[model samples]
Target: MDGLNWNDVRDLARRVAQGEPLLLTAVTRSILLRVAPQVGIAPGNAERALQSGATAEELLQEVSRRISNGSRRLSRTLADVERCRVAGDIDGARQLLNDVLAVEVVPHYQDILRANLAALDDES
Candidate 1:
């Protein structure tokens, strides 16, 4: 149920859309919770899909659209960070980075954020 709430859904969608990890444990659990039973659709098959690299669209309806919007938010956040940095506002950049980091991201993106924060540190 981790990815069911609006904020968590959006965050999960962002991570999934970014292709961070399709085989997330939380995702599989979320899919299991959100997926309604279909006529003649095997539970095993659905479980398989959840285990496999199924996209949010594949797992649940309207999730893909939510994921798309979440992707846009992610992109806009990144752009905002760049814009603030470009404007030479180190505090602003740090604030933006902190806000982004407050959300859940896969480990690699976390590294990129650490790097960003480090670069910000080097700026001031």
Candidate 2:
């Protein structure tokens, strides 16, 4: 809840999307304070509590809790993709994976993503 900045929020969002955890340390909170405003996430009085300290798991959990209220198709898609992967439905998972490459993702992530997609293609 600290005053999150745009960069911080973007970084956090990117990390979250990439399945990485974000630590809620003082540094992380400060960055969030700077980035949140840019993303329209209001920095409420809860900043003090966040500043106290939090783990990446805690931060992710908090973000999930807050975002869960909003009806976003992306969230549903991500969940579906995860479920498909878990269920060994490579084709289903590949179809869901294609949606992410439309955005500019990091090269390393992109490579891994491509590899995953290729694995699915190989199965066919």
Candidate 3:
């Protein structure tokens, strides 16, 4: 992660989304390996996809779709957590986050969920 920047992968996604014919160069591959896990994609899966002769466009599109889906799920789950909190069901909110942590692959979202759980713990 030292030499990796999330923005590089994001820019690549943006470029690909805008129809840029970006090549799947070594640099691109490296960026994907680092950023994929943060977006809920296993680095190994991305590596396998890259090695499977898929075009850069296809891989990038898949990554973009996954990122979108992960974001949406996180939003919905957080909203549910909020609802539980508003209803004075702290245990339910904690359970919701724990359930997400059990399956969520995105590191950023995991951090958020963990932080929310910690906050709930503090309240108790």
Candidate 4:
């Protein structure tokens, strides 16, 4: 995390989406502000944490944890959506994927998610 920043986060997220996980270490306030809402954390709290002199490593750890958790949730949701689709529940799957798309997501991850959503739309 010592050498990490928002760019690292973006890259890591992208790599992860592509089945890779380049290590990351940055988390600037502006980046925090953008990522906070997606991860259910308030921007003010993220700012406060940085203002309190939290190291980039510590903040990166927290951010990485949140991203990991979000990724897991998204995976589960995708599974659910697949089940729904298999059961002839097109609307259910579509809604589930839509909700997933609305969550705070890493930039690269967001692209994959949006693509999945679009594919779902085509299927429907």
Which candidate ranks first by TM-score, i.e. highest?
3
Score every model by TM-score. Answer: 0.43, 0.33, 0.72, 0.54
Tens-place lDDT per residue, model 2, 1-124, is 3332234445566776797756666777766555333333456734554644344344434444433332243456557876897798877888777876454233333455577678677766
Regions of candidate 1 where Cα sits further than 4 Å from its true position: 1-71
lDDT of 1 by residue, 6-117 (tens): 4554565567678766555774555544532221224565566565554433654344443454456557767888999899888998998788767623333445667888
Over the stretch 55-124, how does candidate 3's per-residue lDDT look in tens digits? Answer: 5456677766666666788899999999999999999999999998898766777888899999999987
Query: Lowest-lDDT window of 10 residues in candidate 4?
Result: 20-29
Give the Cα lDDT of each candidate: 0.57, 0.54, 0.77, 0.63
Q: How many clashing pairs in candidate 1?
A: 0
Flag regions of model 3 displaced more than 4 Å.
2-7, 17-19, 40-45, 52-58
Q: What local lDDT does model 1 show for residue 100?
A: 71
Clashing pairs in 1: none
Error of 1 at 75 (Å): 2.2
Runs of candidate 4 exceeding 4 Å displacement: 1-53
- Comparing 1 with 3 on lDDT, the higher-scoring candidate is 3
- Candidate 3 residue 45 Cα shift, in angstroms, is 4.1
How high a TM-score does candidate 1 get? 0.43
The local distance difference test score of model 1 is 0.57
